[model samples]
Target: MDWIAEMTDEDTALWRSDLGLIADAARQAGDVALGYFNQSPEVWWKNEGRSPVSAADFAANQKLESILRAARPDYGWLSEETDDDGDRLSRETLFIIDPIDGTRAFLAGQDLWCVSVAVVRHGRPVAGVLYAPALEEFYEAVEGGVALKNGRPITVSTTPLDAPGRFAIAEDVLKAFPEALKHRIERVRHVPSLAYRIAMVADGQIDGTFVKHNSHDWDLAAADLILERAGGRLVDLQGEAPLYNRIQVSHGELCAATAPRLADLLRGIGERRGS
Candidate 1:
């Protein structure tokens, strides 16, 4: 439960190595996605059209799962491309992956898509990596450790959340709120990928994100851990820590910020949303 004592120097080194290997696997997965990008092999929906998943996602998942399992067979696997395999619960460490985080963007030939990877232990993320192959940017973090982009250390900007800082949010964020707050914050940018949006916050490209419900553990786990390591935080609008790998994988509305200003944003958002 404690991060300071758990993340020793030795632990950091080992996580760093694992992150590099996972990044390589992610890059390979991105290469698989590239083959079908814009070519549109097939597009379909599961359940209620929550989101679109393509053949490329499965292909990239296969490539990534193959590489990771080959290297570390004992680690459990959890991925968006495959059906939920309950067997992962028996292992102490699990690999949570999103092969193509921004499938919509990728299918549209946008370069904002990415491959996200994370190692979780006892319901907490210990290491995380995100690779945007088209953009050639790699981001990673070890728990209680540094966040890096392309092997260079990165930190979130200490910008005030109430100020005119950039905000990245899902398309439905405003729709879920009352007219008062919905019309109050007009500078919101909608991004297709959760991990990419979190990365933007870690690198100070964006100030914050207001995420409505319905994101899964695999979608935000890696990015959440990375943002914390980069001097930022992702918490529920009610000011509680975000949990992972629960029976209900769906997450609640969240507010992410580089500084403690998340409290201010979340308070206002909560009132508007009647949460």
Candidate 2:
């Protein structure tokens, strides 16, 4: 115990207990977005064909920021809708948020979008929540705790690695799968929200999913923790886990699957990447 005297990390239990606040904030954000969803909120493009943002996204972002920041003033903030502050890098804990993930889907009146949020300390997520208002699914997870969906516990699909499994994947990512494995894997219809797609994997609704390059921490953090607690993981194609709240928020190619199938999925992805 004498080797490390200066470590002053917050108790994990404290973080777990605060999931209620994150859940409430996320739900409130979702409510703000629902007011605009399908009713057609003003939309605009960002990154020149790479992404879109809506008025709903901004409204929800403001609501979430006001709620979460006021509750925990010490936490840093990273959000898809907010401009980078750079000050978050020095804080011990931070809020990673996606006011409305799947803004494209929401603009198109699809119900797959969500409000995603997570608390990360020292580069690892300590607590997380994903709330999909239309779907009415609220996922929660904390370090060393079971994942939950709508207040009921959930876990990843137990489908064997070599057996037929449903993969919620993108068209490009699907092309990367080995032909043989592709035959056995059923490609699930495209899911627009990165956070919702990952939650499907956590609740065993889908066996796995792939993330395209250039995803950000806000898009992945909350769901990553849920999937992790559900006995699943989201890792780079090379099988390395990601660290959050970094100076560079963009992430590389990634895949998520239950633990029993992580290796198999990664191997197939690596093969395709090499080819």
Candidate 3:
């Protein structure tokens, strides 16, 4: 059964309440991170120095964990800053969190970072929020509700599928496209936060983006729901949406765009692979 279709009135009401909870939690986490942003809040290397973590990330994570866990003790927790205890796998619902989505950007004083939080039920997100304190942009969505940005509904760009459009994708990936198609895509400057990049697509700031492989649930759960409610999608090469809070949290190469645009983008990618 489709989980969303199976949601009863009580389920919907509960998810909406969870949305409010996460929205406030995200804002609080963002505020904590912002306090150390650009102040060089002591950096540390993780994943063998391939990724950077800051004191700000931990502070924000602490704030989110404290606020969210206390509010919903039964909900499981998965966060980028916390070591996975594997306990969340048994829970029916859990909080997927990225306390600081763009730690590198935050350290550099860039405003593209955000605090991302989502409530996942039965492997899908029910409520999600992305709060960029530096940018002052708050995005949120819940199951059976419209996407919102600071109280206003938001949607993906209405750009025609065949027309030239902007994308947040790496130049190398763009080069894989047919020359004609490559020229039609205007690559935007890199936005350090993967979650914020997807949020841009949801808000119509960009048409789409290509997310490289190895993106984790915390990096995507919140933004995925926001983008979906905004009339777009974030799907893997197979055109399948992600399932969250699984034993394995990482994902493969993915694409995000409005339905029609995503079809075209995926076609181009398939062509690149076929050749």
Q: Which stretches of candidate 1 lie over 4 Å from their true place?
A: 7-10, 170-186, 273-275
- Give the per-residue lDDT of model 3 (tens digit) for 1-275: 28788789999999999998999888888888888977878899999899999899999999999999999999999999999988999999999999999888888888889999999999989999999999899999998899999999999999986688899999899988877678668899999999999999999999999999999999999999999999999999889999999899999999999888788888888888883
lDDT of 2 by residue, 35-118 (tens): 998887888889886788889999999999999999999899999989998899999889999999998889888899999999
* lDDT (0 to 1) per candidate: 0.81, 0.87, 0.92
Give lDDT: candidate 2, residue 29. Answer: 93
The candidate scoring highest on TM-score is: 3
| Candidate 3, superposed: residue stretches over 4 Å from native | none
Better of 1 and 3 by lDDT: 3
**Global CA lDDT computed for model 2:** 0.87
Tell me which residue pairs clash in candidate 3: none
- Which candidate number would show the highest lDDT if scored against the true structure? 3
Better of 1 and 2 by lDDT: 2
Kindly provide the TM-score of model 2 when superposed on the true structure, using C-alpha atoms: 0.93
